[model samples]
Target: MSVENVMTLEKKKGFTLIELMIVLAIIAILAVVLIPKSQIFKNNSKNAGVTTNVNTVRGYLETKVTNNGGADSYLNAATLKTAIASNFSLDSSTFVPTGSSSSEQLVNPFDKTKASVAVADKSSGATNNTVDTVETSASDGADGEVVIYVCKDGYVVFGVDKGGDLTQTFKVK
Candidate 1:
């Protein structure tokens, strides 16, 4: 090849600094836009997981009550713990009951840690927001823990705190 042709070919072999900088800027912009969206999606999935767990426990309770011939009975902490231990196939590595008594814990989807199931005090009135109190307890709240509040007439309330801005609760008659 001619000397001039060879020189031009060598100069055009690689991209210019401006071209490389433009590509980097595009990538940065994409990251800025997509990173927050990915985090939102992650949080949403975790929230869904918490919801599923709450429903699973609720179903277990309902089934137990149904099998007992629709009888309204009081389910204390120990009774609930025994029922859960009997019904679910727990993995020792993940399942850890907290209290020396009969406290049971479930894995929290938000932090992947165990949360204890606590019973609310009887004096606490069962209002529309009763579940909120259970979820916001200073200890044993959130982290995938469940709270059970049994009504005098045999109704049961279940609550779960999902750590941030999300608390779920349901009532079963």
Candidate 2:
């Protein structure tokens, strides 16, 4: 082979500095664009989890009201909490059931911890789409706990976490 040809082939075997810089720049740009979006997606998923738990509590309340023979027989916050804990086989404080593993407890998605259920004040009056007020009105009033606002005609259930709060209102039918 010619010396010139050998030198040209050896030089071409390595990447240019500009090519390496361009690749790094592309990777940096992709990270800049996608990192925030990934966080948003994670938060959205946690919010959805809070929403699901609120709905589940609402459903349980509805069933309880129905089984107790209708709207006239409403459960107070303490009674409702106890009923829920017993029904779910969970402790009121930790939400983990006695003699059960952590996996069996209802977990708050945002914090990755056990979820508790509490009741809001009866006189707080019903507020729609706002969970902050409801949370403050809870009888047990703690962050990362599900709060239920019981009314004469229905129930409003909600939960708060780092991801934010989600609420669901269920009407008696």
Residue 111 deviation, candidate 2, in Å? 1.9
TM-score of predicted model 2?
A: 0.71
157 Cα displacement, candidate 1 (Å): 4.0
Q: Estimate each model's TM-score.
A: 0.67, 0.71
Top lDDT prediction, candidate number: 2
Cα-based lDDT at residue 36, candidate 2? 93
Query: Tens digit of lDDT per residue, candidate 1, span 1-173?
Result: 89999998878978889999999999999999999999888877776766666677777677777877552463644565566655443333334443343224454566544543444443235553332233333253455555556544343444454444434556654
Q: Which regions of candidate 1 are displaced past 4 Å?
A: 1-3, 89-106, 121-140, 161-168
1-173 per-residue lDDT for model 2 (tens digits): 99999998888877889999999999999999999999888877776776676677777767877888864466755666677777766776656445545543555565544555666545345454232233333334344567666554455666765434334444442
